[model samples]
Target chain A: MNTNLYDYAYELEKAMRSSDEFKHLQEMYKSVTNDSEASQMFDEFRNVQMQLQQKQMQGYDITEDEVMRAQEIANRAQENEKVTMLMEAEQRMSMTITELNKIIMKPLDDLYGSMA
Target chain B: MNTNLYDYAYELEKAMRSSDEFKHLQEMYKSVTNDSEASQMFDEFRNVQMQLQQKQMQGYDITEDEVMRAQEIANRAQENEKVTMLMEAEQRMSMTITELNKIIMKPLDDLYGSMA
Candidate 1:
């Protein structure tokens, strides 16, 4: 197989890493990890969030109580400066990935639509 | 910023491209594109699919008629051998991307869960 596409993928990855979003995300991650309490709280928040997503993906409805509980955890986690910064950084990084995925998937999208 | 993470991202991209799923997808893509009729049908299908996705993303309710129309187009497109192969190939490619995205986003996912 021709290696040009693979080479391009590597280049794309390098570009993504150099992006401000990824850099900021890495910085925020470091800051958050530096604080033991904040890091623990973030972990809790992440666990709750993951459970909710898995439930939703499995076609299970999340109850109002569960939503409230998750929101409560999130609110508390966001109170930490590092955690908040991490959240913002995470958003930026996720947006970057979404954009990259769009571009990367275009040829497949053109051939088969967004069905995938 | 430490360049290690970026280097790893590049490696990940290279690995994705070298994956069997990606290889088959590229082959199918080439085959479909070589056939003019199949390629044109695929384009039309893609256009309709994009429109539908945009509507869904915008929170617009798609009418039953629209769904049926899109399904009709899809059915005809699938009748073409190259188109069918392309669709399968696209699915495989998309699956590889999803897997890669999961791996690439692990740190972010660990810090923030699957919220993104």
Candidate 2:
């Protein structure tokens, strides 16, 4: 596994969170369960990501620049935190997955053929 | 007037670029001007912002974390840099501006009245 696997995982997670299909499922779950189970799952995922990031940066001393940058990030997150937009974008992109896969087919096959 | 004016300006610029109204304008300009004047303007704006940020950070030493963070940002920008989505989001939000303004009217009036 590549060191970038974590990055890929993160992107996949983000993509799933942003997807229309996922949103529809979430809405369905909410209606059926009469509870925000999907939303709670998202919060759990975010908490895990935060914990992972905190653990990753454990030994590093927080600098003034980091403090300023963190504050800026927090401010932006608080102000324009549109999780739905992200999900919607993912949904739009999900609809194109087949097209994307078709576009990559030749290159992926070639790469696999070469390795084989 | 405010230190945050730049942020607001940046958001406005982003909003314009993402808007269907603006995208149509851009396509029209490209078709007529036979040049991507709108896109060029956006590039110039981005360059100016970069220069301003560089000037702001002049006295400070760039830390390892900054370097890493910069690389991460660059990679993400390269991969999923959908300027269209940002513009679309802006367009979507722009359409709701009147509604947003209506929502904020009372709070704004209260603040202004207090200041007066």
In order, candidate lDDTs are 0.72, 0.41
lDDT of 1 by residue, B1-116 (tens): 43554554545555555667766877887787778898889989999999988877555678999999999999999999999997897776666566556545555555444233
Residue B44 of model 2, lDDT score: 45
A83: Cα error in model 1, Å = 0.2
User: Listing candidates in order, what is each one's chain A TM-score?
Assistant: 0.88, 0.31
Considering every candidate listed, which one attains the maximal DockQ? 1
What is the alpha-carbon interface RMSD for each candidate?
Answer: 7.9, 20.6
Q: What is the TM-score of chain B alone in each candidate?
A: 0.86, 0.28
lDDT of 1: 0.72
Best by lDDT: 1
Alpha carbon deviation, residue B97, candidate 2 (Å): 9.8
Candidate 2 runs further than 4 Å off: A1-116, B1-25, B28-33, B36-42, B51-116
lDDT of 1 at B46: 92
Candidate 1: CAPRI quality band? incorrect
